[model samples]
Target: MSDLPPLDPPEGDGPDEAPDMAAAELALGLLDGDERAVAIRRVLAEPGFARSVDRWRTHLAQLFDLWPAVEAPDLFARIERSLDRPVEAPVATLALAPPTKSRLWPALAGLSSIAAAGLLVVLVARPVPVPPAPSARPTAPVVATRAPTLVAAIDPETAGVATVTAVYDAQAGAIRLTEAKLVGDDHSAELWVIPADGTPHSLGLLRARGGTALTLSRDNRARIAAGAVLAVTVEPIKGSPTGLPTGPVVAKGTLSPV
Candidate 1:
């Protein structure tokens, strides 16, 4: 057997076919048991056969586990059949052994090219989303309009003080007091709006100087239109004892439409 010719694979096989022949030889070597470990390792290094390498490893591991109990007939028959088949050559076959030092750079460059192409594909396919503008939505203005009736000032007096000037704008339905002054020390001032005919409604406390203005509610519009009396009293800080004026009259005004 040693002197016999190296088994020449069937006709049409040439040195160009050496790689496929080598792979088959490696596969058969895996079943032989002696060099099976080395051959299996070599098959794992071939990219084209890498997936099969895992299957081969699992099969071999099972064979090793059953080695003592029974022979792996199925595994041996499969390898034999595979070796008998004509080698359909791989378009590119990697060396089963490690590459020469000189080829390392070329292999690295090829892998980098593949990675760069993958990154470029990802960047081109995915786009970043832009946020919408805030001002695109509408917003209302603050301080919508002037209060219909604004009381501008108040006057305080000890007794029998009169004259509260009402600045009325008929179209806007508003009235404002332009002047209110306290005449004496004994009396406190209060503000009221008299409608066209109804009783005086208390707006709020009145200050002697730099007096404040008060806005009336919408419900008072009709009564104000009917001529309700706007009057002021020199009420105690707790307010007029009787719901009506107990203190001296201080100032009075009416709301005109605006």
Candidate 2:
């Protein structure tokens, strides 16, 4: 009978051993944390290590493909009977066999590859209890529900003024404004939200386009609630010189939850 190659490197081997062993360990998911990170960096940076990892992965996949299929005819019945049995802690033992072969030098390289692949599969498939790393934290699932949105249609009170439609996203704290016509270049369109307190807080200046999105400050977002009024006014080139509106209110409408 032919001597089989060892699944792992010889016990005395250390970091000074060949890089092929490290690459194999990485491909088999044996390394963890900083060691695994360093291995991954090598795989990316070193062409030789990358090729080794690819070879190991391909060999392992081929080993899995070559594995014989077993039929568990009484598996369900066995599981049912085991349910009635009292649970006990699992027991395991480790045993090492003294080297019987002076050298496992197979005549063919294919024979060595097959032996190495089979041993790697066994090592990787063995069930081992692993405790979570200290730094690993369980994350709570984020449940996303639709955020409340409010829409307002600001109609022109007088002729020659553009009509505006406003959509407010409460979650994003931003308001999207759609206008029928662009505001004149000489005059700037200023947006304001008037809450129940009747205080108008300036949102920002609207651009001379079909629509624009304005992100609100925390204070301004709070003022944008149901029944609140959204008003657009013609101001100076930049905006209202003073905080308050200094020009005529072209269009205004009340916001309601959509």
Candidate 3:
């Protein structure tokens, strides 16, 4: 058997056709943290993926068995009986095996032109478990920033748009929404926060069209952080009926250092 799999796949084994790359990575212990976490969840939740992981493990074991056996080096001191001369001794020195070309990298490289294609391929191959179905309730988007303060741009006017901005004082637990375009007589602009976990939390309705300030609950305030997604949705005069967004996400932005 070959010591390693082919660096390139045969025709038809393109990205669209390959689903075992992730399984190979997982079995090789290449994935880390959330990436690994997601893969593990899929391994348990997806029977097909689990089977792929098993197959990769078997193949890896075969590869190891094919590796050329290396003998350990040793050193010793010896004396000649006639001259009583000390001879060079064989000393065993610890050594590490040279890094071999990984099959994962070749597979990922052949599949994608992207730099760091392994990570991109893993991500592009499968979604990170957000964007639930329409029938399901939406959760907050992942909060990726650690900024003490955050600001966002909100412009949802389809006819005549105006500059709108929002600032969240995470420490003070206060959020201020300033709009150049006021909500119409019956329409209200609702505020929503999408957390790192990718769940949506409605902050509340914007009471003033020009500007409004409100404090978030203890639980909701904790969701304010860098890389968090802030969104504004236009709901009825009273806001969304289902608590989840019922209207389009007209405006959105990421959290940044204040």
Candidate 4:
């Protein structure tokens, strides 16, 4: 809204004057000072004037909604520079010299002769490349190796419930989690890895909606391998009350190298 002066009202709300014009002014925030105060009193006192103000406000709001917001460029520095110094006209200009005839052809001919003599000497002195012996053996091809990545498609305990896809990168020591469905707003989902020892170790809390990445500790990273069990359970918002999972396990699956 602009900080503008209030619009002057009509002398009277008579049959000849349009009182609705004043209502429009008030709705547009063009009414301030005593005029704004009086318009506010009329809005409270008269139901007809109140309705007029409401209609104008709604119409103006719809006009604003029709256009998308635009970001203004930052010109503060340029404005400050202009204020600090007045612009001045350039004092001098550079000009190119006119071309004239010269003995360039003779000079170019002499340079070409020198270059030809140097090329002849180099060609006479350079050694010739030789062919390899036919008995030489061929080199072996190189092979590349990549670190193993573990994947788990965690299935829901009950049919039609939330599911999770866990991918563990051994080299990065991080696990990427992709959740299928949302959990209860009051509760949070947690991830756990159960190794061959049968003890479940807490990985971290899972995000309710989208995919997330969790970096594991040195000990936790060592436990992640093929055949390890990956599970998700519903727990408190922060995490499980106990270090172990207290809530029911929602999804579980065995990890396999991918």
Candidate 2 lDDT tens digits, 94-174: 323322211211121122112232233223333442211333344443434357877776666665444456778788899
Per residue, candidate 1 scores C-alpha lDDT tens digits across 1-258 of 279877968986776755543344554453556556556666677676655555555665655645444332335435444534445224113314333322332232222212222223223323321211233443333332334433212222333332344443333554444335643444566666665455666655556654344555565444454234567777876467666666666554333322
Q: Write the per-residue lDDT of candidate 3 for residues 1-258, one digit (tens) a residue.
A: 479966876789767777647888999999999989998999999999999999999988977756764543321111112122223221212222222323232333222112223233333433322222233343443333443666655545453454345677676689876543445666777888899998889988887544678799998888877677877787888899998988877666666554
RMSD of each: 40.3, 26.1, 23.9, 31.6
The models' CA-based lDDT, in order, is 0.46, 0.68, 0.63, 0.68
Which sections of candidate 3 miss by over 4 Å? Answer: 1-147, 157-160, 180-183
**How would you order the candidates by TM-score, starting with the best?**
4, 2, 3, 1
- For candidate 4, list the clashing residue pairs, or say none: none
CA shift of 87, model 4, Å: 45
TM-score, prediction 1: 0.31
Q: Choose 1 or 3, whichever is better by TM-score.
A: 3
The model with the greater lDDT, 1 or 3, is 3
- Select the stronger candidate by TM-score from 3 and 4: 4
The TM-score that candidate 3 achieves is 0.40
Off by over 4 Å in 4: 1-145, 180-182
